[model samples]
Target: MQHALTKVGPDYDVVVLGAGAGGMSAAIFAAMEGARVLLVERTEYLGGTTSYSAATTWIPLTRHAQAMGADDSRDKVSGFLDRAVGNHSSKSVRDAFVAAGTGVVDALEDKTDVKFRARPFHPDYLYELEGATSFGRALEPLPFDASALGKDLHLIRPPIPEFTILGGLMVDRDDIAHLMRIGKSAKSTAYSARLIGHYYLDKIRQGRGTRLVMGNALIGRMLLAARKLGVTILTETEALAFTTGPDGVTGVTLRQKDTERQIHVTGGLILASGGFARHPTMRADKLPQPLPEFSPSAPGHTGTLHDLAFTAGAYHGDTAAQPCFWAPVSHRKRADGSMAVFPHFVFDRSKPGIISVGRDGRRFVNESTSYHLFVSAMYAANKDGSHVPTYLIADAAALKKYGMGMIRPGGANIAPYLADGYLTEAATLDELAGKLGIDAAGLNDSVARMNAYARSGTDADFARGTTVYEKANGDPTHGPNPTLGPLETAPYYAVKLWPGDIGSAIGLVGDENAQLLRRDGSAIPGLYACGNDLQSIMGGVYPGPGITVGPAIVFGAIAARHAARRAVAARKGDAA
Candidate 1:
C-alpha cells in the first residue's frame, strides 16, 4: 500500500526530525558550525510539547547561577543527582550536561534572539537533598514578541488554550498574579490593563497576540533564530523511514503532503522528536499499571521517530522506576469536541484549604508535594483502582482564594464548568463526597483532621509542610503552615484528577556524545537522539523544574557539535 518516492530532495549535511526546543537547538547549533541543516516537523507549526510548558531550563552549576552568587559546582550537582537519581543514573550524561549547558545557553543568546534569565529563587523539587540549591539553577526564557518572526509567526505553535486566557492572550507567572488580582489592587489593575492593551493591539494588527511568554516565547525565539540562520524548515513533512547505505544512515523517506519523497543527508540524522507521550501502545507497555489518558504533549508525539530508530537498530533505554513525568490533570470538553486538559502544577493543590483524596476520601500524600511526586503517590495508591481518579477537594473559600484546576479564583463564575460536568459542587463536604462517589464519613473525618492540622500548624498524617520544597510552593499569606489550612468552608468543590504525563521518561539509549546505541551498546553511526527521545538523565526522577528540558538543550548542542564534526571529517576523508 506504500507509494514509491517520486523524487529526491536536495541533500543536507544534517537533518533534524521534530522542531521542538531540542530539535531546533540541534539545527541551529549545526548550522552555526557551518553545516547545512534541514529541520523537519510533522505538524504544520514548529515547537512540540515544549511550546506548552513553562520553558524553564534546569542546568546545574551554570554561569547564571554563578552570576547570582550561587556557589553550585559540578561536585555539588553530582552529589545532588546521586541522591535524587539513585543507582540507575547516567553519570557521564550528567557530567556532559553540566559541562556544555552554559555554553549552549550562551551560544543561543549570543548568536540568536533566544535570551534567558535566571530564576534565582526557583527551588529544586527535592530541595532537602544533599547539594540541592534553593536558588539560581533554573533559567526561564524571556518574553518575546512574535512580531519579530513577521510572516512566520503563524508557524510557531501557540500555547495550550487551557494555559492562555481570553482566547489567545498569553501570560507569564508574574502576569498570572496580576490577572488574579486585577480588580482588587491598583497596581494589578494597571498590569492587567497593559497586558490586555498589548494583546488587543497585536490582535488587531496580526490577528494574534505578538507578546509570547513561557514556552511559547522559547519556541518563538528558536523559530526566529532558525529562520535567521537560513535553516530549511519543512513543515507538514514526516519521516517515514531511514534509507541506509554500507556506511550508515544515508537519508530518510519523507511523506510531504500527498507525495512521498526521499531527502538525503550526508552528515547525520538527529532525532529530537518529543518522545512517545501520545503513543497509546507505547504508554500501555512502558508505564506502570493503568496508562495515562491525558498528556500536554503535541499530537505529533506518537513515537514515530522511536519506531523508525528501533527498526534501524536503536535500542530503547531500560525501564526506570518511574517511566514518565507525572501530573494530575482535569479535562473539559471543548466546543470542537476535543478535550482541554489543565495540568494542576500550581495555583491550587498546595494552597491552603485544599487536599487531594482517594476514593476512600482519605489523604494519601502531602498536597504540597511536586506534581510528579503527587501523581507518584496516586500511582502507588491506585493498586486496586481506588485512587485512579482522585478528587482534589476544596471548600468555597479555597476556591474563591486560590481556585481549583481550570476554575478561576476570587469567586469567578463556575456555572459553565458545573454545567459541562468538569466540576462537582455541593453544599456540604459529605454531600460533595457522595456526589463524587467517595466515602462520606471518611471525607468528614479527613477534613476534621485537616482542620486540626490547620489550627495546630502541623500535618500529623503525611507531614505536608515539613519540607522546604513543599513550603516553597505554598501560600505565604496563609498563617503558620501555609500548605496546611482547613477545608472548613462550604459549599465544597471537587475536581476529578487523572494521571497524566508531561513527557516520557523512557527513550532511546544513547551515549554521552548523544549518539544512539544498539542492543550491544555500540553507537549507531550518523544517528543521534536528544530531548525526550533520549533516556532522561535523571532516570525518571523529576528533581527540579526544568530537568526534562535542561538536558534536552544540552544534549542537543552536543549532538550537533558531534554531528558537525563527523561531517567535517567525512568531507576531509572524501577529499583525501
Candidate 2:
C-alpha cells in the first residue's frame, strides 16, 4: 500500500540517498537482508555517472575480469592502487575494499536480476601498467529488452543516436561478417543474412529498432532491479539535514515537493548524494582546472550530504575533487535541443596534426593522454602564467573527419572559456591566432616543431611514440605512429578543450570496515560513507574497472552487513 504524504517520524532500517549505480546496488542489497530501506534521489532518474559515462567497461583486476583470464588479483590490484594514489589512503580502508569488492560484484550479478556480463575485449587505460590486465576484467551490462522497464526507461538518458545502427539495421559481429560474405557464399551467407534480417525486422516491429547500449545499458538494468525491489525513488528531493543523537545517526531531514520533513531511519543512513561537479565556485576552488568538458555525470552532484554529514559531527577526507577522467568533447545541439557527445578526437587517432595548447600558446603534455593527466598538466601550466583559454589546433582534414573533434557533436554548456570565444577556428595558423588574440608567431613555431616530430615519427619533447596503443588510437592511417602528424594543412580548426571532473576524490575517511572516522582516527558509531563520498578507498587514482561503482557497491554491502549485525545486537539487548 502507498503511504500518505503525512510526515511521521518515519523509520527505516536503512536510508540511502541518491539512486545512482552505487546507491541502487546498496538499496537492493540492504532490502534482501530484511532491512526496511528508504532510497532518496534528487532526480527522478536512477543511474548517475554510469548512465552518462563512456566508461562502458569496468576496470581490470576485478573478479569479473579474472574469471575471463585477465590475470588480475586483489593483491596486485591493491598494489597498483596504492602506487597511484600514494600514502594518503588508509590501510584499513584499502584492505576492506579489496576484501569485499569481488563478493559484492558477484553478488549483484548472480543474486539480483541485473543482466551484466564480462566484456572480455575491453582494454585497460595502460595495458602495460603494473597490475594492469587484459580482457575478462572489465564487465559491462548486456543490453536489456527495454520493454521491461517501459515507463521507467525514459528516466535514463538515451544513448547517442549516431552510435546506433546504420540504416535502421542492428549489426553485430556475425551479421557484419555475413554481409561481407554475401557475394561469395550465397547459400551460407543467405542463412546468416536471413537471421540478421529477422532480428532487425522483429526489433522494428516491436518499435525497438534503434538500439543503444554500453554504460547506459548497465544503468537500465540497475534501474529495473531497483524498481522491482520497491525502492522509494524521489527525484528533485533534497535531504537538508540529519537527525542524530549521542548513540549515532537517528534519521535524516528531507525537503521534498517544496515541503520540509524529517524521516527517522533506525537502521542506517547512506550518503551517496555524489560530489560537487556542477557547482562552479566549489569546483574552481577545489580542482586544478576549473572549467570541464561535458560532465557525463548528473547535474545534482553538489556534495550536499557531505556538508550535512560534517555539520552533524561526521568526519570526511579527500575533499580535492577528481576531474572527469575521459577525453574532452564539444557537444553540438540537435533540432530536438538535445546534445550528443562527440568521441572522434579520443577514438580517432589519424589526425596527429592536432595539438592541445595552454593559454600561454605553448605545448604542454601529450594531448592524447587521459583527461586526468591533461587537467593536471593544465594546472601545472597555470603556474607558469598560462591562462584559462586554451586551444585545440587541427588542420582541414582533421576537422572534416572529426567535426571540430569533440567527444560528441551536440553542444552542451561549458563554462568561462565558452563565454570568452575560447573555441577559435581559422584557415591559417596566423589567422587562427588573430581570432584567438594570441601571438601569431608563437603559434606558428609550436606548429612547426610539432609537424617536425610528426614527420620523423618521434616526439623528442614529450616522448609520445612510446606506446603501441597510442599510435593505434592516435595514428590510424600512418605507418609506425599516429600521434605524430604534420599540421601544415590549410584551413585549421581549434576547439577549446577543458578538464572537467566526474566527482571529487575527497570525502569521509573510513576504516577497513567502511566506518566513518573522526579527525583523531577514531570511528564514529553507526556512520559510514562510500563511492565518491568516501576519501576514495583507492586513494585518489582510479584502479581497475568499475573503480567508482565497484568500491561503492562493495563498501555499501560492507556497511549494510555491519549495520544489520548492529541492529540484531540492539534488538537482543532491547528484548533482554
Candidate 3:
C-alpha cells in the first residue's frame, strides 16, 4: 500500500490546515495514500473540540449494529439523513459519504491501533424519528491508555465532566449502570474489577483514565494513527490566508508570535481550520436571534479560510444554518462587574421536574428535547423580544435522583453557582418566585396548570408529560408522571439557563468528492474542507450522535484520498 510520501519543503502533495479531528484525519489519510502532507494548526494542541468535548456517542448504521442483530443498512442511513435536511444535502455529498463510510472505518481499524466495538446501548437522538436506526452503525473506541500518547496527552484537552473515561474510551450513562450491575454479581464483579484495574493501570501509567470515545475517541484514534504514520504536525501556527499566484493557491502565510513567514507548500491545500465559531462579526450576521454563544473551541477559529477562500474566489454556502446550538446556561457578574457563564444545568425534565419561568414565568416547550431543539425554541420564543433567561426548577428529591446540581454530577465547577445566589433557593413556590423576580400571580397560575397536568397525567399546555422514555428518565420520586411535577416543595432550587451552542455549524462548501468549491460551482483545484470548517452536511440539526465526528472522519479520509488522486492525476497528465 502506498502511503503519502513526506518531503518537507516549500512544496508537497497536500497541506492540511488545522489539527482538529477532521484536519488530522484528512492529513493522515491523504498521506497514507502517497501524498506528502503538512498538518498545520493554530493551537498548541491537536484536538480541536474533539479532545475537550462531551462526545459520548457515535451515529450511523454500521457493521457493529448489524453484527449485534440491528437491522441497519446504507440505504436506511441515507434515507434517514435525507429526511433530516428535507433531503437538501447534495446527492453527490451523500453518495460520497455512503460509499466511503466502510473504507474509512476499515482503514482505521486495519491500519491504525484505534480499537473500537459495536456498543448495544447507545441510541439515536431521536430513536423514533423516521429512518432512524437503533444500533451498530456507531462504533465506539474501546478505552485505551492515554499514556501511550505520553506528553502529548497533556497538550490534549481533558474530558468534559459530562463524560467519563472509564476504561480507555468514553462511556455513557448506560455503560455506568452496567458497570455497577456487574460489580454486584460475584463472577461478573471479579471480571469487571480486572477490566477496571487494567484501565486504572493504563491511566496511572499514562497519567490519564480509560474512556469510551464516542465521537471524540474516533478522532483521537485517527490522530494517533496519523501521528504514528509520521504526519508532521506544526502547532501554534496560524494560517493567515492563502498565498495565491496567477494560478491559484501557491502557499500559506503563517504567524508565529511576532514573526510572519510565508511557507510555500506546493501540495494541494486542505482548509479545515474550522468554522467561524469565534468570529463576532459572522455570529452577529448569521445567528441574529441566539447571539453567538460561548464556544469552548480555541481562539483561532476566526474563519481565516472563509475570508481567504472568498478572496481566492472560492464559493461558500449554508452560512445560514446555526451549527452549534447553545444549551441553557447562566452567567455570574464577577468582582469586576464582568460576567463569566457556562452551559448551565439542563435538568432532564422528561422525568417529573419543573420548567421554571421568568419574571413573566411560563413553561415554553417540552424540556426533554435535546439542547439543539431547546435552543431553537428559545430563539423562536425570544425572537419577539423576550430576553429573560429561564430557570430549571428542581425539587430536592429530583435533584438527588439524577445528581442534577453538580456540574457533571460530581464535578466542582458549579460551586460558584451555589455560592453567589446565582442558583436561587427557597422552600416554597411563591417565595421562590419572589426571589427569582417572577410575578407571584403568574408563577401561581403556571404552577397550577402544570400541577393539573401532573394530576391528570397529561401535559395539556406544552405536553411535558409526553414520551414514555421521558417519563422513565424522570425523577422517580415524582408520583405517576415524571415530567409534570409542580415544584411546590420545600428546599426548591432554581438554576438560570441561557441558550448555549456546541459550536458554529455551516462552513466551506465542498462537492461530494470533498473538493472545496468555487463561487461559480467549480472545484478549487486541489483544496478540500471537512468537519466544522466545511458546511455541515447535516443541515444545522444534529441528526444522530457523532453527527459532526462521523462526517468529519469519513470525509477527512475522503479529502485526503481525493487530494492524493488529484496529485497522481496531475503528475500523469504532466508526463503525458
What lDDT score belongs to each candidate, Candidate 1 first? 0.86, 0.63, 0.66
| lDDT tens digits by residue: candidate 2, 194-286 | 766655775665544323355566666777776677665666678888887887887788876767778877667777766655555656665
Per-residue lDDT tens digits for candidate 3, residues 389-505, read 667777665554454433333323545767887777677777888888776687678777877777887878766645433444465566767666655556777777677666656
Model 3: residue 174 alpha-carbon error in angstroms: 6.1
Q: Candidates ranked by lDDT, best first?
A: 1, 3, 2
Query: Model 1: per-residue lDDT, tens digit, 349-413?
Result: 88889999999999999888899999999999998899989999989899998888888777688
For TM-score, candidate 1 versus 3, the one ahead is 1
Candidate 3's displacement at residue 54, Å, is 3.5
Candidate 2: C-alpha lDDT: 0.63
Stretches of candidate 2 off by over 4 Å are 1-9, 55-63, 126-129, 157-212, 258-260, 278-285, 289-296, 318-345, 348-351, 384-387, 406-424, 468-472, 475-477, 542-546
Q: After superposition, how far is residue 402 of candidate 1 from its true place, in Å?
A: 0.2
